[model samples]
Structure formats: structure tokens, C-alpha cells
Target: GGGVAAVLSFGVANRLFTEPRERGRTIGTMGAVVGIVSGGGALLGGALTDLIGWQAALALPGLSALAAVRVLRIAPATQPRAERLDARGAVLCLALAAALAVLLQARTTHLKESLVLVLAVLAVALAAATVWHVRRVPEGFLPRLVVSNSRFVLAAVAGFTLFAGYLIIQFAAPRLILMDHDLSVTQIGLILLPTGVVSAILSRTAGGLAHKVGPLRLVTALTVLSAAGLLLAALAGRQPVALVIAVAACVSGFSAGQVALMAAVPHLVDSSVHGVAAGVFQLVFITGGSLGSAAVGGMVGAMSLSTAIGVLAVVPLVGMVAAVASALMVKRQTQAPAPAAGPTARPAVGAE
Candidate 1:
């Protein structure tokens, strides 16, 4: 998805710039831009669909894409030419992802379809093969250098947990808003506005706090807060005022924590493979969101709405465990003395 692309680009750009504070500001601005565009699109699309046909409404975005291509063609290349494209690995990875996507669609949307299981199994196999191939192949799809770092692994796990919690809440929010409050889509967006706005405003500030208090601690605290928020939302379900506040708390905390994560991940990784590390982090976060959406969607479909919301809360609880592990790991690694590079020269006891 283009949203995934945009966020990945933001991560890579932060790595390239190597300025933490500026990266926070840039990401905040990007978030603001996204909020505006998404809000506008919702309103405009609704209007267009109501006035004209849905097909005609879709044509507008197609026209916009044509204009976007022209703009992109004129844009200057900032990256070095030395970067080699891993064509085979890329194709294999994409194919595996496509298969997984199809399987998910079939399982969720077309339950009667028997081919989903076969596709899912094939997808898993292809993905495993892709990973194996990449490690052996020079300039493969996955950047080998990035995966070597323990920090990258930690960051990815933390990112996964964080996004899982956030997306689960996101999937549940609209249902709660519509069913509990009997609000229109427009009203729901307006109610959600404060959460997004506060998050955008606070993220840079959160980044600053993270710099002072450390991302590991900030992330842990935020993870706890996110879980608490979700629990509160679950308890406050069908209660209009409390539900809104609870959802706001969940969204704002999760988003601010993401900014802190982006800032910390690059520094945690080896400098030589920073770009690839950031890319991996982004990919993990996106994949986690997908999984979270699926998990939440399924729970909502099968169980009661309150149960779905409560189950979603467990995602952030998992995030708390990850955050605590990451914090302890970082502390242990940071505090531990580095081994001497060479054998220490022994001073003769008599000479001393």
C-alpha cells in the first residue's frame, strides 16, 4: 500500500539525515499532511459518490495518479547509483506476499473458498524459500548486514507489538463509534479528530522526552499506557463520553510511541546498514498492523463487540512485555564493558 511506502520512506529519510530532532519534526509534519489529506479524501469521496456514480469517483484518483507520475518523473534522484537491485529475490518476496494477501482475502471475505488453505501453505513455503535464498544470494532482497544486529531484532519485535496494538484498536474504533453512539461516519471522524491532532502535536515533544529519558523507558511506559487505554475503552464500551476519551488515550499514546521507536531504531543498529535496518523496521511495523487488523477483525466478527475490544487490549499487554525485554537488554548491553581488542600487556609484579 502507498501508506506503507510513505512511512517506509520516512524511516529511510530519518536514517539518511541522521538528525533525530529534525526527523521527529519531519515525521510530525508528514503525519499532519496525512491527516489533512485523509480527512479531505473522506469528505470529498463521500460527496462525489453521492452526487456522481462510484465509478466516476474512482476516476478522480486515477487522474490524480497520472499527475503524480509526471511530478515524480521530474523529481531528482537523491540516492547513490551504487545500490544494486536484487531482482530475483524481490520477485520471489513479492510473489510470497501476494499469495499471503490472497489467502487472507479468501479466508476473511470468501469463507466458502477451499483454495485458501492451499494458497496459505504455498505462501508460507515460498516465504521460507525466499528467506533462505536471500541469505545465500549476494545483494538479496533482505539486507544481510542489517539482520546481524541484535538491536534490529529487538526494535522489530517492539515495533511489531506496538503496531499490533494500534491497528487492533483502529479496527474496533469505528464499530464502537457507530453502534454505541449511533454516529454518522462524518461525526465519527470529527470525534476522532482530537486524538489525531493531539498525537501529531505531541509526537515531537514525546521524541524530545525520549531523548532525555531514553526511548526504551518511554516505549515501555507508553506500551503500558496503551494497554491501560484499551482496557479502559473496553470497560467504557457503549458509554459515549468515557469511550471517546479512552480511545483518544490509546491513539495518542500509540502514535507518540511510534515516533520514539523511529528515533531509537537507527541508533540501535549498525551504522553501515542503517538504511536497511530502518527499512526492515518499517516492514515489520506494517506487517504487524496487517496481522493486528486481521486478528481484531476476526474477533469482532466471531465474538461480541466488547469481547473483541477486550481481546484487542491484550496486544498492548504483549507490547509491554516486549518493551520491558528491550529495556533490560539495552541496559545490560550498554552497561557491560566492551572486551579488550588485544591481549593486555602484563606488568611484572616485581617491576610494579
Candidate 2:
């Protein structure tokens, strides 16, 4: 359900803004809201569980969703159009995703080595088949033109790698704090609370900065900052103050980078395919997070947590390189002559 919301929200965001600068600001504002909610969620959940029960805590999202429905009803609607649903592509993608999840889970479970290998092979095969089939189908589930754009491809890579690093911190930091310091859940939440606050404040500023500095450069710089945060986490040991500072840095960088990446998406693809492109971009983002969590979990099971974190620090550095490449790609594309309009080229529905 969260995944569905993410895809739909991104699609809506893409259609709602055409000017890159405005889009950046809008996305940054949205990121601020997300940071506030996510930052407070842990503390709220702990309090609710303590006061009432776990069931009440679990119902919070449903209540939020109900409130969202009220807002959505009053929102302006886009023109509806019909397109053929690519059933084969959909099935293949679903199968591929499931196989990959199972493969990842297997690494942390007591599954036999042979079974893990089989799941890995199945996932790879499904992925290859999905790509092959999508390329052959005109107007397939995925937008071919958007996928083919060098700028979009690099942006997707940048999103994936940076998000993986962020997820690693999210998954590891709480565990490290509890294990090393023997802190209560409430205490842990308090220690990490500053992260969300810093993220919310930075997110709003990041959009304007992206508008001035360019999305690629902003993303690259934020990613480098995220890498530095991860390095700090690796060396933080049991120091509470160091951990708080490190986590705040990670959260701020991650939030800013995410907004910049989202702002760049619409410019990289034709306006007509905004919804599909956003969905695909989000899918990549979620996939990276899942992979990061799985990789870190598996590593922790095999070695010391600090050692695992230190190793995973390389992920954000990779994202930094990808961001640089994306900047170059966008520059090259902009300098090149404009190509003839294809089937996907249409005026954006909600350009202001």
C-alpha cells in the first residue's frame, strides 16, 4: 500500500509541475512533510503501544489514509485516457520482483545454499526476459523512450545507489544504538529525532538550491555528504553525540537528494509519459532500498555490524559518481539538436 501511494504521488507530482525550478521547490516541500511524519512516527508508535496496544499503533496509517481520501476527492482531476495494459510485462516484472525478494530473504534464513542459488538464477532470468519483452513491444507497460534516455537512465542509477545507502543507515543505526548503548526504545527515538527535524528543514531549502545550482550538481553534492555521514557512522562507535550528528547528516542529505532527483525526472522524459516514467523511477528507488536492507542484514549476520556499515559506505560513493555522470549526460543532451516529436511528445497536462 505504501508502494502504491509512492508511485501515484510521484505521478501526480510530475503532472502538476512543468517548470523545473517550481517542480524542485514543490518536491522539496513535499519532502519536508514526509520528513516530519516519518521523524515523529517512531516516537508516536512507541507512545501509542505503551498507552494502548500494538493494534492501535498499527491503525495509525489507516486513519491517515482515510484523511488523505478526503483531500484527494477535492483535488483537480487529469483527463482520462485508455491504453492497452501490458499483461505479459506486468506478470514478468511481478515474478522478477518476487524472486529477488525471496533470494534476498534466503541469505538471512537457514535456507540451503543450493536453494539460494536457484532463486538467484530465477530472478536473473525473469529480469532478462522482462527487459527483452519490453523492448520488443511498442507502447509497452514501460515507456521505451524514457527508458532509453541517457539522462533518465543515469538519474535512475543515481537514485537507486543513493537510496540504498540511506536505507542501510536506517536499518543499522537503531540496532547499533540499542545494542551498544542499551537504550530504551523511547530514548533511541529521542536520540534520532533530530535527524527528521534537520531533514525537514533542509528539504525545503534543497529545492531552491537545486533550481539555482542544477539538479545534477545538487544531487552529487548531497550524495557526497551522505557518504560522509555514513563514514561518520562507521567511526561513531558508542558515542551518543556522534551518532546523533551522523544520523542528522544522513537524513538531511538523503531528503535533499531525493527531492532533486524527483525534480529532474519530468525534464528527462516527454510530458505525455510522466505517469509511467514516475512509476518506473519509483520502482527503481524501492528496489534499491530493499536490496540495501537485505544486503546489510545479510552482512550483519556474517560479521560485526560496524564492519558491515563500513563496507556499505561505498554505496553512496557510487551514487556520487552516478550523479556526476548524470550531470554530464544532461549537458550533452541539452547541447544536441532537438529531435523530431514522436508519439510520446505532447503538451504537459498541468503545465503552469
Candidate 3:
């Protein structure tokens, strides 16, 4: 329910703001709110767990229900589309995510080879089925319209790697800090709190920046900044300054990258598919997060934490390269001479 609800914010932004800068600014404000809330929640949940029972932290999510009232009040007026519900596709998606989660973590965690092989086969089967279903029912789960747009697909891929690196730093950093400093979870949370405050401001700044600097360039630079953070962690995580840089970089990357992508989506695909496009784009990237977290958990026992983080840097580094390539390609295309069009020439997508 939360995941479904999460996707709606971008869709609403897309509907409400047609201009790129305005939408970017709106999404940045939204991202800032998320950063502050989640950062505060980390501290609150940690305190609750330490001061009271672990179960006390469970109440935090119940507080989230209060937001639904606001959601109802502000969500754009929307009508239900009458398309067939993609039940099979939805089920396959859940199954595939679960299977892949298990399989990815199975390796360095030392699961029985036979069990790993079985889960591997199951994941492959589920992934195959999902692809077949999406292709067979293009208008269903993943929508042919959204998938066909190269910009949309590229943005999704960039988002996935950005999140993968972010989560890797998140999962890896706290454990390393605890191991090194023996800090309480609450203290760690407090130490990280500034990241949220700073990132919130930077994210909001990114909104205005998007108007002057191409969003793709900002995104690529942010991704590179995150990868560099991980590299610093790999090299000097024991140092206080590097640790702060590591945590702050990844958090900023995700917060600002999300704003950039959210604003870019309306320009990537038709507004008609805005809702689904935002949903699928989020799912892909957040799923990358899950994998990154799993990778750290699976590999920590088998390798040095620094080595694990260095390995993690590769994910976002890949994203940075893709982002750079995409920006260049878009620039070249933008500069190229327009083909002579007949009466039916459609305006380019970025014109929106």
C-alpha cells in the first residue's frame, strides 16, 4: 500500500506542473520532506527500540495513516481507468522480487549449493515469465507506451544504479561505524541527521538548478559524487570526515536524483501513462536498493568492509557512465539538423 501510494506523488506532480523547472522544484520540496521525515524517524525509532521494547518502534508506521487524510485532500482529481487489472503480471513481479532477493543473498551467506541452484532456477523462470507477460500484454503491467520511450528507459536504468549505490553505502556505513566507534544506534542516527538537513536543502536547490543546468548533467554529476563517496569510504572510512562524506553523498544523490527523474518523466513519456510510468520507474530503482542492501549483508563476512564498499561503488559508477552517454547523445540529437517534415510532423518530446 505504501509503495502504491508512493508512486502517486510523482504522477500528481506530473499532472499539476507541465513546466520542467516548476515540476523539479515541486518534487525537490517533496523529496526534502521525505528526507527530513525519514531522518527524524530513524532517530525516533532507534530511541524507541533502545529506551523501550523493540516493538515500540512498530507504532511509527501507524502514525503514517495520518498522512492519508492529507493525501485525500490534495491528490489531483483522478478517475479509474477501465483497463484489465494485470493480476498475473503483478504476482509475477512480487514472485520475481522475492526470488531474486533470496538468490542474491544466498551466495556469500553460504546457503547449500543445491538450494541456491533451485532458487536460481526459480528466479530465472519467474523473470522469464514476467518478460513474456509484459511483451504479450504490452498495455498491461509495464505498458508498451512507457517502455518504448528510450528516454524513459534510460532514466529508469540511471535511477536503478543511483539507488543501488545509495543503499550499499547506507547498509555498509552504519555497520562499519558501529564496529569502529561502538556508537549506539541513536547516536549513529543523530550523526547522520545532518545529512538529511543538508540534503534537503541541496535537493530543493537542485530544483532551481535544473532550469539552468541540464538535469541529465546534474544527475550524472550527482551519481559520480556518490560513487566518489563510496571510494572515500573504501579508502578512509575509519576517519570521521570521510565517513560523513560517504553517508552524506549517497543520501544527497538519492534525494536529488529522485527530484531530477521525477521532473524528467513528464518529458519522457506521454502524460496519459504518467501514473504507470512513475510507478514502474520507482519499482525498478527501489528494487535496485534491495539488491544493494542484500549484497552488503551477503558479502560482509567473506570480505573486508572497505572491499565490499569498493565493490558497491561499481554499481553507481556504471550509472554515471550511462548518464554521461545519455546526456551526450541527447545533446547531439538536439543539435542535429531537423529532418524536413511533411504535414504530419510531431514536435519533439522535450518541447513539453
Candidate 4:
């Protein structure tokens, strides 16, 4: 949860430090750094666990927290309105979310406990009260305008689909590699490396494409490609040659779509609301990720490998549908003329 909070904080950071060209490089660097640390730490930690004992893994996270503190101290802070941090609303939300988290965990653990059931009901009520509070409270944590925007709603849905597909692939691929094809962990990592490297290289190009072609067209193309790639991956399953090609396409399409979507966001809505809109989209994305992990894992356990792959492909297919809908809406919006202002502000008559 704390890790998720840190990642969420970076969304505001991204919007704060907005230079089109530079933003891409910044995200890429941050992504690369995270990838190296996560991957390298796992590799070293595992070795240390085997040789030096189990406590070595604990040091990695401890060190990471210390590093985060140092970085936060040095990092520039951009003060959005202090009012944006609604204390009462935050407390209610945290309580509700924590309850749900506990209840979800309970299903797999001590299910006989009445406390879990009680907490679940309490969470639902608290969430309802939170919504009511948002409506009535002046200077609350959530802004009414943020929730009311149609574009934000659509963007949130799209973000959910994008991350759902990503999480599904991440969970499924390793299983397909290890159980079906008998590949070692090192080999699985090696196979996955190419996709991440390619994404890092192509992210800048994707951002440029978003600007030049307009986000709708670029995103639509990428989303379609993503759907196709997932479908292909479903078929490839355990076949190494086919799996590699399919995974490459999936990674490229997903990365490109993400870049285009992020670029489109500021253009799709008011700049003042960018931080809130982005945060909502991110929240949905994280929710979808959790759902995807559970859903995919469940399907894989219940059905055969082929069936699991088929189920996983459905997420990207939904994304393709959303992409088409968004493109059409954008086109319609573009074709509409801007409303004229006050009578005196109207375009000059016969001036040209």
C-alpha cells in the first residue's frame, strides 16, 4: 500500500514537471531505474538468501526506504492547494479501503471469523457516507468538478483496461514459461528483457506520434495492436518461438498506447484539473491491476492453460472496443465548431 502511494505521488510530479520532450525522457529514466533496482535486487537478494541467510532480503527494502527518504528530501515540492488534502474524507476513504482489503484477504484465510463480515458491511456503509460527505462538505478532499467530468470518466475506464491487460500478461507469462515449457527463472527473465528494453527505446517515439497524429488515432492503432497481440499470445501459449514474437508485440503495443494516453490527457480536459483527473485514472488502473491478478490467477487454476490464455485475451479486446469508442467521440468533438463568445467578441465582420 505504501509502495502504491509512492507511485501515485509521482503522477502529480509528472504533471508538475511538464515539458513534452523532457517528460518522456524523465519517465523513461525513472522506469529504467525502477526496473533495474527491482530486477537486480531480486537477483542479488535470492543469492544472498541462499548463501548469507534469509535476513538479506529485509535489508533491501530497508535500504530502499532510506533511499526514498533521501530522494524526497532533495526532490522539489510543488504545492497544490492544501485544501486538496481533505483530512476527514481521507480518513473515511482509508477506513473503507482498509476494510475491503481485509475482507478480501479473509476469503483465503480465516473465513469463519465474523469480524471479516462485519468489516465488509462497515466498509460499504463508510464508502456511501464518504460519497455523501463529498457532496455536502465544503473544502473537502475530493472536488465535485473532478468526478463530474465525462472525459475523466472515459479516461479512467481506458486506464483500467490498459493496466488490467498488463497485469494479466505479467502473471500469465511466467506460468506459461515455467510450468508449460520448463524454463528456469533466469531464462524467463532473459526472455522478458527484450520487451522491456524495446519499450524503453520506443516510448519517446510513441509520445512524438501522439503529438503529430493526434492521440486518438495513435492510441486507437496501438490499442488494436495490443488486442491482436494478446490474441496471438493466447494461441502461442507454451511455444517459445511463437511466445517471444507475441510477447514483443504485446509489450510494444501496450507501451505505445500508454504513452499516447498520457499525452492525450492534458488536451482532453482542463489543465487545472489535470492532477485530479490523472489521480483518478491511476486509481482505476491500480484497481484493475488487482482484479486482473486475481481473475487471471483464478482462471489459470480452474481451467487448462489454453483456457486461461483465452480468458486473459478478453481484457485487451475490451480495451480495443474502448479505443474505438474514444476515437469516434474525439472525431465528433473535433468536427464540432467552437461556440461564439459575447456579441462584441464575435469574429470581425468583413475585416478579411
Instruction: Return the top candidate by TM-score.
Output: 3
Tens digits of per-residue lDDT for model 4 on 263-309? 77675667876666656555666666666565666565457655765
Question: Ranking by lDDT, best first?
Answer: 3, 2, 1, 4
Of the pair 1 and 4, which is ahead by TM-score? Answer: 1
**Model 2, stretches more than 4 Å misplaced?**
18-21, 337-352
Please list the C-alpha lDDT of all candidates, in the order they appear: 0.66, 0.77, 0.78, 0.62
User: What's the C-alpha lDDT at position 37 in model 2?
Assistant: 61
Better lDDT candidate (2, 3): 3
Error of 1 at 212 (Å): 1.1
Assess every candidate by TM-score: 0.79, 0.89, 0.90, 0.76
Error of 1 at 142 (Å): 1.8
Q: lDDT per residue, candidate 2, 65-143, as tens digits?
A: 7757874875459667686678888788778877876666575776898988888888889988988987897578666
lDDT of 1 by residue, 94-180 (tens): 677567555544534656556776787798889888878867874566776766556667666767777677676666766776775
Worst 10 residues of 3 by lDDT: 1-10
Report the Cα lDDT for candidate 4: 0.62
lDDT of 3 at 245: 75
Give model 2's clash tally. Answer: 0
